[model samples]
Every structure is written in structure tokens, then in C-alpha cells.
Target: MAAKTDRSDININRSMPPGKIIPELVYDDLDQAVVWLCQAFGFKERLHFRNHRCQLVLGEASFIAKANPTLTESSNNNRLQPQPNQMDHSVLVRIEDVDQHFEQAVKSGASVISPPKDYPYGERQYSVEDIGGHIWTFSQSIADVDLSEWSGVLSDNPEDAF
Candidate 1:
């Protein structure tokens, strides 16, 4: 006879919400990265795991962080992510006030990539890099300007080509 296993302690309702995308990031020092993210960008720690991985939440947006994987490990594809401060991609977030957020980030010692500026498409935006060298773009909508007026694009009719 097969032995019966107890299965009373399980929670199936705990999982990420539907239609939510969570981006994963790698850091050299996850502790400092978490602290910097909270201080500079206002993300609260949602969960911490094994001293190497953590989850950060800001409103409905969230991202998971893990220590950078070793390059010598033998795994499928045998590849590793680019070192911190070397990646070219950036994370963009929408906020209420671009200028105030920019000031706070600057005060928290984040490296400024671009100062706040208004764009024709109705966005006041700025860019910065955190201590782990992750580029972040914070933007706020300032207007509802028509796209056609700025770039002469997005025609109303299909025959308006060229």
C-alpha cells in the first residue's frame, strides 16, 4: 500500500494578478539597490528571499531583483546578463509631478541622465540612473496636444499618405 501524504497546508490563491507584467532586474548589491530604489524612487519592499532576491512594489508597478548570476556557470545557452551599469535599456514610469520627483531623485544622489523637459506630445519627463546603474525615465502628462500638429503624422484618413 502507498503511504498517504498530508496536503492540508497549501495556499493556491496567492499569486500575481492577471494581466500584470513584472520586470526582473539584476543587481550587484541587492540590499543597497533596494535602499536606493526606495529612497530615490519610492518603491517599498514587498518581499525578500534568501538574501539574494527581493520584490519591490510602487503602486501597481513592481519589479523583482536578484543577484547577478555568475558568468562561468554551465547552463542552457551558457550566457549571462550584462554587468551592472552596462545595459542600454531603461525603465519608464509615470508619475504625478515630474519636477518634484526629479528633485527628490537628485537629492537622493541618483545620477541625472537628462533634466526635466516638456515635449510636444504632452509629457514632462526626465531620466536618471540609480546606484546600480539602472536607467529610469519618469514622466508626467502635461497636456493633450494633437500628434498631427507636432509631427504632421497620424492622419485621419487612409488616403492622406505621403
Candidate 2:
């Protein structure tokens, strides 16, 4: 078998392009969803769209919410309708301060879930359930720790054990 040869002079892509990551959450009402999203996650509305079908929708952070069920269904594959005892999904949004964001959401009519708490992953995060049953978790980076410390308590094994 021949070993693969590198074509370094060909200008091949050595570094990956930045990824565009934006998750869209669908709701039964676009207007209400927009309000809740802005309040819960602090997403800024960017644009809106409408057609002859009367589907009023708005876009924020690459996410679009529809005012009607038909449009919501078409926008997001993980469309939701609150069940009796089960949850369909949740959205985790990165923020500067989860405690402050949680308080803001509470003031904006969001139902509190777990209060902002520190996690092993260096995040102080909290949860809120919107009126439409969408779960939004706001998280903030807390501290930088070694992976071992992050996993739990630091190991006491001798450094020479390796």
C-alpha cells in the first residue's frame, strides 16, 4: 500500500472555517414566542417575514418563530406541544450572568425552574419554563479549572504515578 502524500503547495484548507451555530425554537404563536425568547434568552430580533398565507414570523439569532402552527412546524423539526408529564426539549443559552438572567426572566413572567447554581462544568446556570412550555436554560461561565477539578475533587495521586 502507498502512503498518502501531502499536497501542501495546493493551498488545501488547513484550518476549518468558523461554524455558524444558531438553534431555532418553534412555538404556537410567533409574537408571544418572540417576546418570551427575548426575555428568557436575551436574543435580539433581527428580521421578520410574511407571505400571503398570513404567517407572521420573526427571526432572531438565526432562529425564526411563526405566529401559526403550520409555519412553526415547517420551521423547526422539533416542533412542540406541552404534554401532561413529559418534556419535548430545552434550549441552553450562554449568557454573562445566569443569576441576573434568571431574575430578568422571572420578572418577565417566566416560571422558575431551578435557581442559578454552579455546576462542575464551570457554569452557573438556571432554568425557566416559558408560558408556551419551552424550557430555557441560561448559563454563565464561572471559573476556569483543570479537567480533573472540573470532574470533581482534585485527585491526590502522586504526580509521578504516570
Candidate 3:
């Protein structure tokens, strides 16, 4: 493999370049989901697609939301039909302050899954479940620690260990 120094080698236009991965989520009620996400998670609405879809942004992160298709289609994907207060996957959002975000989220109607706590990995974070049953974790880095302190071995070859 060759080293990539800039977009010039990839032929990506600066104005229309690709961004970090944006997650796609499904909800039983997209309108309610949009409102709840904005109010609870502090996401800003970027675009509204009819009444069934929406684009939301928070800082450098963004995600797309669509109405659930469980009623329209007969598929047994449990993930598509998220039960109330339960979710298989969670979104981890890097925020400026975990304690403040936790309080704001609770005041905005987000159910607390976990309170703000510090971790050995050098992050202070908190978790909450949205009205749509999606888990959102807000994290803030509190310190820069050596990996060995946390049982992570440093190897010359990055892929040599897991």
C-alpha cells in the first residue's frame, strides 16, 4: 500500500469530500424522534425529508433518521423494531463535558441508563436511552494515559495484538 498524503491522490473534490461515517436509524415515529433527539441530545435539525425522514447534526457528527418499516414489511429483524427502552447498539458521542451533558439530557426527558463516571480508559462518560429506545452515550476525555496502565500492550506492529 502507498502512503496517502492528501486528497490530490484520491481525486476527491475539496468542496464535496466524504465525511466520517453517519449512522442511519429507524424509528416508529420519525417526527417524534426528531423532536426528542433535538431536545434530549442537543442535535440540530439539518434537513426534513417529507414527514418520514430527517437529517440531524451535532457538532461534527450527523445522522439520518427514517420511519420504521416494520408495519409496512414483514421481516423478523428485531433491530428494525426497537422495543421501548432496549437497544442492541448505542451511539457514543464525544462531548465537552459529561456531567453537564448528563444533567441537560435528563432535564430534556432522556432516561438515565448510567450516571457520569470516570473510566480507566481516561474518559468521563454517561449513558441515556432516548424515547425511541436508542442508547446514547456522551463521553469526555479527562486525561491522556499510557495504554500499558490500562492493560493495553503497545507493540511495534499495530495489528499484532488485539
TM-score of every candidate = 0.74, 0.64, 0.78
Ranking by lDDT: 3, 1, 2
**What is the full ranking by TM-score, best candidate first?**
3, 1, 2
- Looking at model 1, the pairs that clash are none
Candidate 2 local lDDT, 1-162, one digit each (tens): 333235332333312111234344455666767766676556665555552011212232244444545554354445446642356777776777677777778888888878889988788988878766777677789887677765566458857443
Those runs of model 2 whose alpha carbons end farther than 4 Å from true positions after fitting are 1-19, 51-62, 71-80, 152-162
lDDT of 1: 0.76
Best by lDDT: 3
Task: Give each model's whole-structure lDDT.
Answer: 0.76, 0.60, 0.78
RMSD to truth, every model: 8.8, 9.5, 4.9
Q: Write the per-residue lDDT of candidate 1 for residues 1-20, one digit (tens) a residue.
A: 33323433332333342114
Q: 1 or 2: which has the higher TM-score?
A: 1
Model 3 lDDT tens row, 1-162:
444435444444322213356677888888988988888788898878676668888887778877786643554555574676656788888989788778889998888989999999899999988887888889999999889889977779888543
How many residue-pair clashes does candidate 2 contain?
A: 1
List runs of model 3 lying over 4 Å from the truth.
Answer: 1-18, 71-79, 154-162
| Residue pairs clashing, model 3 | none
